[model samples]
Target chain A: MTTETTPARVTVGTGDPVLRVRDLQVSYGTPNGDVPAVDHVSFSLQPGQRLGLIGESGSGKTTMATALMRLTRPPGRIVGGEVLLGETDMLKLDEKGLREVRLRDIALVPQGAMNSLNPVMRIGNQMADAIEAHEGRAARKGMEERISAQLARVGLPPTVARRYPHELSGGMKQRAVMAISTVLNPKVIIADEPTSALDVVVQRQVMQTLGRLQEGIGSAVVLIGHDMGLIAQFADLIGVMYAGRLVEIGPVDEMLTDPRHPYTRLLIDSLPKLTAKGKLVGIPGLPPALLNLPQGCAFNPRCPYAFDRCHQDVPAVQQLAPDRRAACHLYPANPALPALPASVQMDAATPLELTGPAMEGQEEVAG
Target chain B: MSATPLLELRNVTKVFQSGVRKTPANMTVALRDASLVLPDGTATATAIAGESGSGKTTMARLLLGFIKPSEGQILYKGVDITKMDKAQRLAYRREVQPIFQDPFEVYNPFYKVDHVLTTPLRNFGLYAGEEQKRIEEALEMVGLRPKETLGRYPHQLSGGQRQRIMVARALLLRPRIIMADEPVSMVDASLRATILDELRKLVSEFGISLLYITHDLTTAYQVCDDIVVLYQGTVTEVGSVEKVIRDPQHPYTRLLVSSIPLPDRTQRWGEDDSAITEEQARRSTSGCRFAPRCARAMEECWTQIPPLFRVDPDRAASCFLRKDAPVLPSEQVGQVLKVMRPGDAGNAPAA
Candidate 1:
């Protein structure tokens, strides 16, 4: 949490953070027992700052996003956390208060555009419903103009308002969804993989629209996705999640250039780059199951540089630089991170079986 | 390279009827005059890059013989596959294999995962003996341990694991060419690189050519030797990955290259000014398929269809910007005949 107050070496943004999440914990109540989907994760976002949370499936990125908006469904409960949006604690808000704060203060651009939009509802009605839910329906004539403006904001033509969801293309539907979510001009936008199923060109256009809207509204954004390239290109700050934990959080340039966490480094290296082409590298073992995690560090079984201490004690999130934080044994508080092994420094393509001695007896689940 | 290409699609086009009734209004041209060549005697990976509805999948299905092309021929080693008999068709199926997009849907939940590996062996008549050895070798080649993957249900394995097993199954046949359609799109991000690496290894280690069909251009650029960029069933650009990605000549190719979200922070995506809607693309029936969305659309682009003009010795782009460049002699005039006006023969390129 100290990293939130620290003046970043690079000018991330100039303002007190509008959204702060402290020790956020979310769990799913299963028949066997309680399974923590999101561990004690903490981060803050200054107004107009773009924070990208990158993780693989079941890494708790979506869980954290839903929890921030108090949208955790049944079986998934927010056990502990303080979601401070401006001055009010979102966790303390009642249903009525939460509804008011949701769209007016915080909005969500959900992943699947096809399922998110109502099939029968016209695009303009969908946008109107979002506005009329918070704003009273007295100003009926102005709603049409507002709807067209929102549509035009995301690059959709005004004619799109007359059509149904099925009538529009995939990109148009996604842009329409964006328009609906931002109609209220919320202070924080939680876009959960808005471009997952879209094509590369359309994905670019959608991201640009989101960026432009965020800038116009001066809202902090928490963009969650699995694509490393997309996160790096759009976000100012990057947060890498693993096994329901924020393994590393830092500036995008710094994290990509010199990553402190081993998982972050391996994940970055795994991505196929446009700048260069070579043998592709992927993380060796599968991510640890959330229900049955390793005793010490969750990533110990796959990390090449993991040592003895990493297997016995869980590493707390430690501040490595003025603006960066990582949870790894390689970087102690007093001496910063030591030099990594030569094997990891060589190329993106690490040997298939490169792992520390801690990997012994880890029962990898078989099909 | 050999005298004949390993597999060649000579001016192929596929049209699908959209409505229950047989009508031209309901006909959707899934593919239009798409041609490709995979040289023999050398291992290469060629990527067919396009977005959804761009006819990339149609081209893949055509090559795999899942559907017949309405026009042109699909040749294998200079012999037409569509005209082949039962024995030749079986042989052709063995020579070319497919790795589908969704790893989960491909498997039947009723059977254990081993059925996937063994059934192919039996069908190809390679399971008479040493079946276990061959299966293990294929799995190991794709970085899957036989102990972890074998004797398990498809549900028990991860998406990445299932995809790797599919790659292993494809390898078991020792096919000359593997047609992988979006092989890694369904897998997790961390596992995508592993699957792509395995696909790359099939080229270098096993001496097999790869026809990688996907919308993701970054991965294509990373692993492929050459690329064919398609836009709404039309082949817009074809060249080596280096030349095409580094310096895109076609306007559509340029848009695609610029649209990809790279990892580098310094270079961000430029703002798009042109408003090229999908409706406009649907309306343009005769001109270049991408002219509606193309930033460099001209008067000629609206009427006459442009052939693949030679940007370089090995590169070609279907754009009027390359009008002065020599036209590729391969299926140029014949392929564009569908879009030609009644008296447009005078403007046709010299063969």
Candidate 2:
């Protein structure tokens, strides 16, 4: 495949993008058939830019992130797409090449501190393992010093290095995991729900630690989480996913404040505000199963403003504004296609009607 | 107001004795002098908001009569629940229903979802004729269709659907009070509002008092009329949700309020230096539990446990900052604990 570098208006450092993903497709082979977990997802990450992939469970956000690193397990395969990491097409790289790319180029801070760390190993041994695996065995002389330095960077006491995973608190373990992931200083870090399990105050501290670490390393971050509030606080750009597709991607402020997509609007509305006056209304139905997703737009069944076009035709991703794109019938690329009725156009000021036919437990499931 | 409360915990203090040989160090003070009342004849919702190990679970367990309080009496309609007979205990169980955090745990994976609804009906001897209609009505009340949710295994339904089914089961009992412990925590954010709305509707429409237990202040603010902020198992602040959230007097309450990541992008967490290390905060067992972490902690705050000082007529915060203020007696505080409206300052206590 020919590598085409699309010029982004808001480049990170005035050069080719640091990490560019094009037409990424990942599918899970179930007993019934092949289910497309991540279908035609594409996004670019500029150097040091924080892109938050916000979605509910089973929305394929995690699958897409894992697929980028080629870390997808059995039954889940990356069928298509180009994962270009600074001129290198990562998809084409072999096992040897991928290993080098994984540690040196991109690292992952997996979800849950408890599951991520090796229970039996000391914190120092875990850090050393990553460093030794990537930087080679000869670099062991200064490994202890490097580990302590990284630990301190994330606000963990250097004495914590000798302690086991269970010995440290949840917050400390989380910080240690972050330290280990960033010990090598990769170009991009993908932290998946790093603080979801922590308390609010502890979560704040962890987020602060992550922000400081990200700044110190100057690496592009792909933060995946279910919390829109946390994502809005941390991310510069936001991508909203629903049913194995990237519904919308734009600047975080613009996307959050004035989201074009109905799903994005619903997510924002669903969030219980500390300062809200009235009761919050949730989106009516569950997201469609990936195996038997609804025809045309996957979100049509749950979307309050879904029209006839949304039911029959898949909405192509259209550039709604500069540096902003959304896949919805409302924002059609073609001039001939009619936009959604003005009455149903959801905005911050207008409250959406909760009762709908779709909300009455009429879900279409495919066998 | 009635002289007797629907349910009440009088100076409840629970200590969990850990390990084979119990020691003072092993004894975890889950709750310390925690007192609250659920008023009868009105569908008032009070949120027990606290983080893990803050004793929200212990309080819930005490309310459910699963475990006896090490000290203090749990009164139901002015009767001590601890001293209740088997017959009285059964009645209490029927009236006070609990909705736990994980719906999957409440349900058996092998059994059909309908079993959850039918089991309660069968046990209560209400499954003679109108079982199907009653089940349908209960499901409808929680925004679920009987046809869609019934006869399906636990794995077939979503977390939100499963949780709603749990609520539907609770509704079947026709309980006077429903204690929902982190009901929406495991459910998706999109589905949380619907569950919360159902809980709120139960209060208004069905006149069922809800004891919403959660760590998330956002949901508590949305559904609850009153807020009880817990720190290290102690009631840090208990007042109208508006008063507690809008102008939090307790330092811990303020930290919790500010720490929540709002949807607004401009809002950022305070500097790291302002926050106490988690280890330090958790280790301190003396004085004000929040004193080590509190930015405004005075020397007196470190050595003295602050009493529940009345901030206003309807609001009380346990903080040394309000130490100089007039303290309302514990007995009087419970009687006058009316839900205050947004701007309804009946009488302003001098600060």
Candidate 3:
């Protein structure tokens, strides 16, 4: 594993570059067999940059995040992909190595992450518990100092560490979890919608704290959320996942200004603006289920631009520019199509049959 | 736009008495002397925006005619919903139906999905034979297929689907006023627009006035034209949504609007110093309740209970500052913008 320590680029390699996943395919082994929850996913991390994992539910964003910390539950195994950290691949690491990585190098702010903190236990005790898991030689006094430092770093008064989780507000609890997540100053931090439940003021403050903290430790951050606005603000790189596949990957500004995919355009256009006072022009259909994904492009069925060629062939990641990729046949070098009306979204119809044409005149892409 | 108001809350005051004695001893003033008039056709969608302890939900219950107001009357199409007796109340209820915040909460898990809508139509005597068109129309209105979903249970549908059915239930009655409370907050984002668009049709095309209650300010502004900002059971601000949200004069109103997280990264939070504090909320105020948090609090503001004073023809704010407002700060945004940093993007541009 080799990574360039560029301030802007997330090329992993330097001393267990926080987190790394390559061709990571995760699937649920149901009675029928394995259904890909995360199909051959790959990504890397860098210090201080927030990598936003954006997608609708069932797009495998959650599963992908869980796989990073080796926290995927039973029935869902990491079938493939090498998650490397420096010289060692996390998947190949023994249980003890995994334990060390989980605590020191990679800490997961788990999904439904706000409640991960014990409500009945004091915040100090919770942090201490995490510290005790790896606190072999540190004195009790040192641990206390670490706990207080963590609490203050997240903008909470030092005494908040002494309060029970229940005693704090929803925002406070979220902040406390953030406090615990960053205490050890791990190389990588994976936070799942850390500010989803918080109000705007607190939401900004939380992200502000994350940004400041990121700058302080230069820890590579993996932030997960549905709202693209938050992603655009914090994340340097944005990976748009759809139906268990990366539909579009690029720089935030690049994606926002010139989205190559219709789905990406629809997501941004659907955002109801205060200035534009009206019901949002939303994408016609709901996200496709990972269990029975459609042939060809998952978005082809609802896509207005889908012509004779859209339904048959699966479009691979086409690199339109440096660091920018789109899976739509209508990308750079491909013939252009008219801008589709995203608002023509009518009643929720049953899943439409995927019967469009091939991207390169090939067989059905739905298989 | 209509000559008469489709829905009206005339000095509506509702008190909830708790405890074994069921006394008014510790009655929660759910709504206090609230009054609003939504002229038919003119009022597209009206929003009741407030924080957790704010009386936004209580006002919704009143508008739905779920419970009688202790004082005052609720007028819908020249009729009082709260004052109506048994039979009259039932008939009147058909015209003013409620769509609860949690869609599944309104339906019985044992029954089919269509049962929720069909049951209401049947009760209203619009469920049989030729009336079948009404069922299909209701389903079409909410974007559900009657054939595909008629036999489905609540668990079978998504949160967005369940909520749409709830809206269809109200549509089945052909209600003039539809009271929807936080309908999309519990649902997924992709499906929210579908439901929101349907609500817009209720007012625009169908000509039904919508009393939409929500905490999400974005959707509130999107679907609603008028807004009622509630604070501790009082109407802190009320008027057309544009004037109220775009230029919030009330401290509580400003705080609530500012607290909502926007999807745009360029936006920053509006931190009005006047946003009432928790300590200020503990005890009721003699003057303006928000005076404690009001950045423009004056010596006179602390003593006199500020009456709802008109700022414009359609907008009003219950604050001493707006009542013949004196020399105010040139930079009025300082109160809110003080806490907001350059990079903290919560405020949308001037739009």
Interface RMSD of each: 8.6, 9.4, 9.9
By DockQ, the best candidate is 2
lDDT value, candidate 3, whole model: 0.69
lDDT winner between candidates 1 and 2: 1
- TM-score, candidate 1, is 0.91
**In order, how many clashes per candidate?**
1, 0, 18
Candidate 2, residues B66-156, lDDT tens digits: the string is 9999998899988899898888888888889999988668889889988988987888677589999999988877877777677778777
| Higher-DockQ candidate of 1 and 3 | 1
**Model 2: how far residue A193 lies from native, Å:** 0.7
Q: What is the C-alpha lDDT profile of model 1 across A21-101, one tens digit per residue?
A: 999999988886888878999999888888999988778888889999999997999999899998999999999999999
lDDT (C-alpha, whole model) for all candidates? 0.82, 0.80, 0.69
Which numbered prediction scores highest in lDDT against the true structure? 1
Give the CA lDDT, 0 to 100, for residue B342 in model 1: 36
Model 2, which residues run further than 4 Å from truth? A1-14, A333-367, B20-22, B273-285, B329-336, B339-351
Error of 3 at A161 (Å): 2.2
Name the lDDT of candidate 2: 0.80
Candidate 1 chain A — worst ten consecutive residues by lDDT sum?
Answer: A358-367
